[model samples]
Target: MSYYVRERLPPRSTGIANRDQDRGRPAMQREVHLIGGTRSEAIRLAPVTLAMREAGLLQPVMIAAGKHTGTVTRTLAAFGLEPDITVEGTGNDTVEGTRTDNGDDPLLRELDELWSVRTPAAVIVQGDTTVSLAAALAAFWRRIPVVHLEAGVRSDDLSSPSAQEPDRRLLAQVASLHLAPTPLAAMNLLDERIAHTDVLVTGTTVLDATLAVTTRRTPFQNPAVAAARTGSTNRLVLITGYGSEAGGEPRMAAAARELAERHPDVDVVLAVHSGQVDALPGDSRVIVTGPLSYPDLSRLLCEAYLVVADSDGVAEEATAFGVPTLMPRDGGEPAASLTADCARAIGADTEAIVTAASALLTSRFRRDAMAAGNTPYGDGLAARRTAQAAAALLGLAPVPDAMPVSVPVLPSGAHA
Candidate 1:
């Protein structure tokens, strides 16, 4: 799942901290190989790479690693990055953009082989995808330090139908540095007996990407989606990426149809994850489309009246824009998935969704109050903090101040 390439650095096998004290080594020998994940997760690491490269403290090797070649490549290109080494899966190896198991054993072996020849000083990974876990394992096996970006995120409901839950927990075992997105996430690592110094609360990096892309507006490819933003009487209930868990599930679709029926004035755009279109509602007001490009998605969030999503990263984005968001998981979401201000954890039941939807729709004050809440996500400085943490892990420079993150206000209770 992970793709890796170096800047032709002479492979240094581990012992990075010791090597740092050595007389000036070429920047290549200080290579910090960053493995690219999905577009959402990859953008989080993008700022870190740019920071590191700009500092000239360590060689930032951007590697594109994912099943969806086009998606991965496009994401890298978004930040003016192209993987020095690109790994593409063909035949049964490849999968759609959404994360589902695509046999990472081969990725493990491939990374193992690459590192055996030319090892990076440290390997950086993001989130809890197979690509992140595989990169961590491969780096760990070689005694290379693994820097985990967005570490210590755990779902409130283990039975919440997300496949990547365990991957984050297991990642903590192998990671040398945990760049937790929130103080709550950092506390989760500390509770597990991880060293206090090893965890840095950097806030979520998605906001950085979101803020950057929001400046660039693009016409939505689907006319229906574009129309949702323009109509004065129409409110956009943007449902982003039902995710791998929502496939063949009628509950969400049924809920969407009911919401459409209840509110004839609003436009409900169901931007579904690829390969899960079969479960879409049959209502005319519920405009269904495949996954949206990052720019289009950002534009929708800016223009949306309300948001409903299950993808873990959208919570951060919704918070960034102060958009009132509803997490549809029945078990609720982790602390990172909700903000103090505008988000609520509404379960997957049809009636519950409709009730929450109706309340948000009927009351302008409620929606505005949610929007007025302070963003729990970062003030867009997470990447700079993350870059400093990665450098400090190599003993090259001091990590920038660990920005304070407020403990998330969970609906039922704290995720901690």
Candidate 2:
């Protein structure tokens, strides 16, 4: 029998622990399933889990599954979270709208079995990844409402190498609630004919995660970062990426070479994909390392003098910390980077990178001013807003004291 066809059973508890006036009993818990398989998804979703717990709303059941299992494990650990359930998966594919292996088919089967066991009020999926697409599809098939977090991002162009565009498009269509991270993103959904009532500008959860760590004032945990922190004469420039146009190791190598030769006082740290390490510039000034743990990267961002990255996620992180960033590509950057004057979009070339870095490095006043500007990305309450939205959808009330303040959306066309 199809899982969706099973006889529906009344929930045992509301999980709220609140007294039911009519029945003079505590309500039953509403099971809200959150599924993710990648490190990025894990990092962004951790805050939402905390917010939901604090809100006394639907119970957030975290399920970790995907190729980047180790990274996912570490990110959740940094947030002091343990997954309630973990689906067995083994594929290294991170591209959206594409599967790494047939591994996810079994995962889909597992999800079906789960739904057969107990239907959840909703399933939450974040960002554009293969696992996200699978989770959304599986939940939709089971007739469970799919809440899409960080929805409606667009490069505005259809052509792309990866399946990110298609994955996002499909997920939006099936998503019962769209949590757009920006007004521009909301506009993207609206343009696609998604109802305005269903779309909301909640800001990016990444900012919430960033704020979580920064507020705690976590000590520097990575030795490389700590060494850089103590080197008063060595300015730290954190770099990350994998795309050829944006993060290609060749491009990273060129930029590293130029910076190392021109600015010997700066320490350039290139955090690249493990496979591409052999392609990077062999320079002492360029500290080529494997992928960093979430906390390590957070600490590096907190203390880095400047950030030069090709990935949008890294840009968001740097902007959150008020660190100046130089995007090595022309487009596909978040609006906050430009609006906050915290980042510059430089074409993916050695000279453009070198020029931008040199200018930012020489101007201490400029960097400080960028850091002090209002964070155009978020105000550290996205997770709360997200939880509240989910609660409304599930017919559950959130804790009144933990309600989120209204966050203004950016003007349309800011990043399109």
The TM-scores, one per candidate, come to 0.81, 0.81
Compared with the true structure, all predictions reach lDDT values of 0.70, 0.72
Residue 350: error of model 1 in Å?
3.5
What is the model-wide C-alpha lDDT for candidate 1?
0.70
| lDDT string, candidate 1, 1-416, tens digits | 44444455444544435544432676535778888756766678777777787788787877666566567778766667777676553312214433455554666777777777656778999988777888899889888889998888876434433446667888999999998887778888999899998888888888777666666554675676666555445777887755534442355666677788888888777776654455343566787777787777776777677888876677777766767888777554646534465678777666777788789889988877776666666767788887778778767778788766543321210000
lDDT of 2 by residue, 115-223 (tens): 6565677899999877888888888887788999989987755566566787799999899999987666788999999998888788788978976766666666756
The Cα error of candidate 2 at residue 15, in Å, is: 18
- What TM-score, to 2 decimals, does candidate 1 have? 0.81
The whole-model C-alpha lDDT of candidate 2 against the native structure comes to 0.72
Clash list (residue pairs), candidate 1:
none
Clashing pairs in 2: 13-28, 13-29, 14-27, 14-28, 14-29, 15-28, 15-29, 243-248
